[model samples]
Target: MASRRHGDYWQHVLDLVFLIGVTFKAIDGLGEILIGIPLLFITPAGVTNAVHHLTARELAEDPHDLIANLLVHGVNHLAGSDLRLLGIYFLVHGIVKAAIVIAIIIGAIRVYPWAIGALTALTIFQIVELALHPTISVALLTVLDIIIIALTWREWREHRSLRDTARETWRWLRPAPARS
Candidate 1:
């Protein structure tokens, strides 16, 4: 009984962690969609102008504001084609991620393998991007993906175990046949 209680406690903790991770990923997907919509509609010059306008007050207040300057510099360099491509990329990425999350939340066991596969592929792409860019944010995102992948694998295993146990119990409870 003590062992069972302990196991339940850890299971609850793991479930909570999984929930939090999923929530964050959902929010991230939404953010990507929001950004993508604007990129799709706006021209590169318009984006640069908007970023400058948004950052103007901050830059005035602090001439050395790193984020404002970075945003300005990044938008200034993007071409219209680049913005369009990026917009499409984010839109598709966000939609797929949102769909996967919904499937997993709805308790579709079959989706688990596909979800893991998709995430693994994305992680691999991110890793390649990180190699090229070497950004801190990208590195952190890669680490987060690895952690979520592990947690997801754990949940998958737990669900399979429960399913197997139920099958065994049903077999044991079934009536045996009698010979004539």
Candidate 2:
């Protein structure tokens, strides 16, 4: 009985760990979305300001027929007209990421194989994106993501195998009922 209790405890711990991983992934997705939303507004302004300052410096050196050159490219790229569209795009992206996380969590809880498979595919995409991105912060984050993926994959495989083995053993252990 004590062994059975211990087994149950370990199983619960495994489940908790899986759930926590899913929760963490979801939180991470939400955080990225929130951060990206502000970036759409602030980035253009900041870039424009910086470019204006640089152009002013260049003009101070030689105010030749170059006023046209002062057209800040960053501001041009992030024109206010596009702000709403960009925000919507980012918002949708974030929502999708968050949704995937939630789906994975639900699937994990229910032991749904498809959920696990989908999560695995999403994890791979994340890794690939992180790898391709040039930012130093993102590179570090990519490393972290790879580690998490590796660990989660290992845990998932182990848990799945253990469950399968246990089920088979249970089947074998059940005695055949005596025919009257």
Candidate 3:
């Protein structure tokens, strides 16, 4: 009985952790969409003004400002005709990320195995990207991903143990048929 209680406690903790992770991803996805929309529609002058104020550098000199340069160039070369198309592109990217977040949340709530697989794939992708980038920030993010993966695996194992215990208890409690 004590073991059963322990199992239940661990399962609850796992559920909480999964919930928190999904919530965080959803919030991050929403933020991406929100930020992307405004950036996509920024006029050439607006882009230059924004970048000048933010970084105070020529966009060509900074690879980090590539997105800003693209926006400014697109607006200048294509006029306002391209703005709507760019906006649509950003909106689609945002929607896809947001949809992934929603799927993760739903999968976690349902305790579906696919959720774990999805998270594992995401972690692997991040690690590979970090390796290729080889930057201090990316390295730190990779470390963070490792910790998250460990916690997620632990939670999954605890949930499995709790399910096994419950199944065993149910089997034991089943009444035997009367002998003829």
Candidate 4:
């Protein structure tokens, strides 16, 4: 009984983790969509100017505000082509994440493996990005991605086991054909 209770506790914890991870991904996807759609319409200079304007008050209040300065510098360095490419990348990534989240939420067990594969690929991309340019935020995101991947793998395995058990039970309970 103690062991069973422990197992239940772990399962509950894992379920909560999965929920949090999925919610975070959903919010991230929505944010990417919001930003990417605008980038598709705005020119590089326009985006830069917009960033500058958006940060102007903060910059004025605190000249050394790291976030505002970083945004300004990053936007200034982007070319039209780079902006367009980035916009498309974000849009596609967000769409894929949204689809994966939907499938997972709908309990599409068959999609679990594909979702794991997709998430693993995305996590690898995050790892590569961290290797190229090590930022604290990116590092944190990478860590979160790793955690999410582990949780997703656990969920997939548990789901598969449950599905297999159900099938086995169904097979056992089915009436056998009468012998000819």
Candidate 5:
């Protein structure tokens, strides 16, 4: 049916986003781990000094001052331990998200609940981060997560319905056994 095809089309699109998300998360995790670790060597004062220099240099060129200021502010606030902890969080979260996405892609119905739980947790975390840090990107990511949750729920229901229908049909189609 056309509706089934429509669902299939959306499913494929979501799967593609998952594939892309896996890559994005992997890159973001690496960025956090690699960049944040090195940044730990510097004290907050040192970060402040760097931000001052960064602002000076960025101002000399034609670039977005808002970006420079945001980066400076972020670096100014975080301590060494905070950076390391965030780095570790990103790496672990990335790995888990990728694994779940892959499982879902392979039609692992069992992972749907887990994926939903993990995504819900992540969305909550993002909301908290938005409260604390208040970035546009964080807000956008939250919105995207909400959309993904809806799509995932729809897909899960469709898959379950199809599975139940198949089982019922199989039972009905099977030949009746002879009575003893």
Candidate 6:
């Protein structure tokens, strides 16, 4: 009994955490859509000096911080369009994730199967993106998506079971038809 209650509690907690995560992505998407892509993008040539300077500072602060140093160098090496492309991805990804989050929150039973499909699509995209870029953050996000997929499947199963039980109970409680 205690384990059951604990499981229920953890399930709720996971749900809340997933919602918060997706909400942040939604906001991040909005940010990229509205401002990051439009205003902050710079050509590699335009930011060359700044990138070198920043990278140098990062290395000076902590010589062991290779990832930070590497990212600065990497962005400067990338084409200007890469930033814009990433921004576009974030914008679209954000919108889709938010819509799915809303559907899940509303307990739309039909949405579960569709949500799994949608998530699978997103995961594939993320994997492609990861292959292209290979950043730690991108890798972490892909892992998070996998976790959400599992949680969503669990929720979907529970929803179906609950509906089935309700139907059975209703049938048992309903009055029998009178003789013709």
Give the candidate number with the greatest TM-score: 1
Model 3 clash count equals 0
Stretches off by above 4 angstroms in model 3 are: 1-20, 37-48, 55-97, 100-112, 153-180
List TM-scores for all candidates, in order.
Answer: 0.82, 0.41, 0.44, 0.81, 0.62, 0.60
Native RMSD of candidate 1 (Å): 10.2
> Which parts of model 2 have CA positions greater than 4 angstroms off?
1-24, 36-43, 46-93, 107-133, 160-180
RMSD values for the candidates in order, in angstroms, are 10.2, 14.0, 12.2, 10.3, 10.9, 11.0
lDDT of 1 by residue, 74-110 (tens): 9989999998898998887788778778877676767
lDDT of each: 0.76, 0.56, 0.55, 0.76, 0.64, 0.64
Cα lDDT tens digits for candidate 3, 89-154:
546645654675564444343443444565566567667867786566557745644554565456
Residue 70 in candidate 4 has what lDDT?
Answer: 97
What ranking of all candidate models by TM-score puts the best one first?
1, 4, 5, 6, 3, 2
Q: Residues 54-166, candidate 2, lDDT per residue (tens digit)?
A: 78767677766255263654356776656656666556656765775565444453343444455456556656766685555556655655544554565455544334434
Which 10-residue window in model 4 sums to the lowest lDDT?
Answer: 1-10
Give candidate 1 regions above 4 Å deviation. Answer: 1-10, 160-180
Q: Candidate 5 overall Cα lDDT vs. reference?
A: 0.64
TM-score of model number 1: 0.82
**Model 4 spans with C-alpha error above 4 angstroms:** 1-7, 160-180
What digit string (tens of lDDT, one per residue) describes model 5 on residues 50-167? Answer: 7778687886684668888777767767776776676566655665666666666566777777877888888898899999989788898788777766656665666643233334
**Clash number for every model?**
0, 0, 0, 0, 0, 0
**Global Cα lDDT for candidate 6:** 0.64
